[model samples]
Target: MHLLRRISTGGIALCAAAVTITACGSENSGGTTSHANGKVVLSIIVPTHTAPPTAPHAISAVRAAATAINAKGGINGKQIEIRTCNENGNPNDAVKCARQAVSDHSVAVVGSYSNSSNQLIAPLVKAGIPLVGFNAITPADYACAVCYTFDAGNTLSFAGMPAALRASGARTVTAVTLDLAAAAANVSAVEQAAKAAGLQTVPPVKVGVTSTDLAPAVQAVIGSKADAAVSVLPTEQTTAFIRAADQAKAPFTFGVVDAQVQSVLSQFRGTQGDHVLAVGAYPPLDATAAYPGLVQYKTELDAQEKTGDKDAATRDSISLRAWLSVHVVAQAAAGITGDITAASLNNGFRTAKDIDLYGIQPKWTPSAKGHVPGFDRVSNARVFFMRINNSKLVPAKPIAGLDLNTGKPF
Candidate 1:
């Protein structure tokens, strides 16, 4: 398969589009450039009004992080000012967001998500602004010099799915993906990963985009007689399939489900979701008390919620990634001797060997050598394999993370 061959040569881009995230956008807007009273300008570009409508959570996470930092003297006395733009999943809009970040003199773009990230990287690179903690949706994100991704992208999640399922005592696993031409590569990647893990792979069951009734798809999984089922569908379809599977009482374990559907499925206790497994870019949202940073994050979120911020407490892959992204930039800028500008912050990100994210994620080194040949910008390659227990997400493995490219526990 192409994904396996790429693993032998470079890295694979499989499953990059498997997940959809929200980003903010507008027709013509720029970040705040007026830097008075020692303020550090940061911008986040995300998609809003897209499918799943979760970009607002990411925005709230960034705001919560900034609010917390500012309350205790932000980044060595420089106030953090965040500017947000809606990319709306459009390449042209993504470019405009990057241009706005440049024109507004943003030191960095932090914790943003968009499928059109391929269009967002170039202008930021030319302007010497570091792009921090963005959802790695495109090949450009993995290779760009200034792009620092704190969490493993979907590429890593797809590569690691088979091993995660195999650990759950599955002898044979079947994949269920959206019926798109791009999803073919994702299935191939899963096949290769399953082969490496000594797990048998059944032919995938593909669902149409507009299919309303998921009864046929549910029956397909039961008929395959696979020990486990890995779903690579969108939020709505995944939700529908889970409901159908629950109604059917399918015997196979749900080895993988969309992380975006966690919030939706958390309410269904003792159902199919109880055994639903998830591969997340960050730690499971339900394990808030496990990390000290997350405890602080939740406290700030509560404070924001009291002030009428609706999505303040929203916890998902995108929200956690965005929250950590802002802190990564803040920690890097904390030690800057002189003025903090785009050039200084970019240089700081490049030179800073190990950036501390307060245990929300592993320490990231932007200057570290790339483990995979084509994915030079992958600062951290750890992804958590989690399961839902009593509607709460907990670790599937004894270890916290797996090497995303290899599916080996780290």
Candidate 2:
């Protein structure tokens, strides 16, 4: 498949009729400036008003990374400027953010969190803009040729759950997921991964996205007589499921995506969270002994917090992902010697070597050759496991590797 489709400047002008395209009239607008002391702007699109309230943390991380990058003489001697647009958990707003990025002449959209990937990708792909460090919340984000996702998001966690659960002494697993399309995809991925791991899985119980009661799902899991259960719901819904499971005295261990485990810890007391596993793209922030990246992240976060940044102090999976995204953008941009345009930045990314997260995540080289089927442009297939202990997440041993195209461990 031909991934890169370059549109003529006139085509971009004509395409403006399809949507409400923001005009790029100013120097810091949609087109990159040729000024000697010009700044390279990077746009970050995140949801701040919607259900999953983690966008602020991600936004703060982007700003913090930009601050750090600028302090070190910036990328390729040009200062990095970060512009943000809140998607507000709406598809139309996501499109608007994409238009804003294009209008701003952003080198790339880095470390953004949005569920409306389909709406976001069209404008970006048309403008030859690359999206990096975004969560794979939808099929388009995974399949878009112009997008380079670092992590497989929930899919990575689901794929690694079976092995993590087996290591935790779980033999049979039951899956609980939302009735949304994305959740269904996660369930299928998990099922395949479970089979590959030599683990047995029962039929998954689907819950409504807006459902407040999770007793039925918990009852189904308890009745399944499984040794472990996996939940592919939002953070709030996952918390409800866990609480119901705890109240019913479910025997099976519980597992969720890394992002869901952050605030839900306080909901489970004592041994409630003991056997709960959280599979993530990066290691725990406290895992300083093994991953020096966590140490650097913490230091920067702490500094941001001390300077009155609200999002910096509250570290979560989304924030960490955003931080990594900014690093990836900076690392790629630092290697460019010529003009840093959208195409040039993407070329730098495609050729980047040793793209490591300081042992927090496995080294990955983002290239078309590394692309996996079904996972679209995602090249990174490594996941770290963590178990919740007394309301705290502790790192599990041995990061699991998977061939995302096959949904099996490599």
Candidate 3:
């Protein structure tokens, strides 16, 4: 598949459509400027209105986290301001936001809603601003000259979901993909894993990113008659797919990857999902005590919203990873005594060997081989596979005596 994606600081233009994120940042908009406060203001950008209520709440959680970080003397004692825009979950919008983010001369930016983040690398570099956000870049896309992305390296997604399936003792599997980047990676990786596990393969099926009608895909999955079924589509689409799959009553079990699992369960919470199971890559944020940073974030979110009863907390990897992205810039910026220009940020990456995210995620920096940087150590890969258990998520353990490297069941 070939696509001509125009990426710049103005915005990400997908095909002929031009999209721009809602200019809701808390920083000054400019190309180049001098700062006297010694304060490095960072803009936080993301698609806010892409998926209905969920996207907004997710965006708010990230903003809240940034606000919390700022209150606590922010990175290098610099006060952080968050400028945001609605990507509308559109790639064009993503590119546009990134262009504005880079050209506006803000101290880096955080943004994404899956592939939306991938749409802006070209423009981000053109604007000469550092873009530190979460986007599960393809192992190959990392080679792009324009991509200086700082991934959080919380590995395991559809990447690990297939392993979970093999561990479950399923011998045959059929999977569906949205035919998008991340989803395709999951499907391909899972298929490879299945073959490695000596499982049967069913021809792949595809879906569009914006597809809400999954009846055809559901029927296809149910008719495949494999022992296991998996879908690596976005959360909302996964819901539609799951609902249809459940209705199809396929004998094989159904599974999902990452937060889409949460979204699936949350979407169909309290309903019989035909005993469907969802797998996620990260350690469940809500399963444990809120990351000590979460409380501060909550307080800041409350202050921003001007409400007292702020009950919702940020328990997803996106916001946490975003918060870490800012810290990364701060940490890297601390090393330089000069102005925090995009060039300086890039220079910091070039010079800094490995930037530790203080365990927030993993440390990353630009290397000669790969353009973008982040923790790549196998041990640093802290993705603990988990599955939805009893309507909630639980850690999934590898089979006993399994070859850790091969990930084979004993």
| Higher-TM-score candidate of 2 and 3 | 2
TM-score of each prediction: 0.87, 0.83, 0.70
- Candidate with top lDDT is 1
Encode model 1's per-residue lDDT on 1-410: one tens digit a residue.
33333332222333333333233222122222326556888899988764654487888889888988898898778789988898887889999999998877788899888777767877777666778888875555665666777767766655556656655677898888889998886677666656656678899999998987888998998899887887778777777887788888887777553455666856666866765777766776657677677777777778878889887766677777788888888888776777787767766776787788777777888777645445556757766778766767787765555665443474
What does candidate 1 score on TM?
A: 0.87
Q: Please give, for residues 1-410, the per-residue lDDT of candidate 2 as tens digits.
A: 01101111111112222223232221222234323348888899998774665478888888888888789988888888888999988899999999999888888888888767678777887777878888765445555655776765754445556666766677787778888775565676566556555668898888987999998988888888888888767788888888787778778888787787786666678867765778776666776887788888887778778889887877877888888888888887778787888878777877887787666666767874433434445566555678776677787644333333343442
| TM-score pick, better of 1 and 3 | 1
Clash number for every model?
Answer: 10, 4, 19
Q: Rank the candidates by TM-score, best first.
A: 1, 2, 3
Which sections of candidate 1 miss by over 4 Å? 1-38, 370-373, 397-400, 405-410
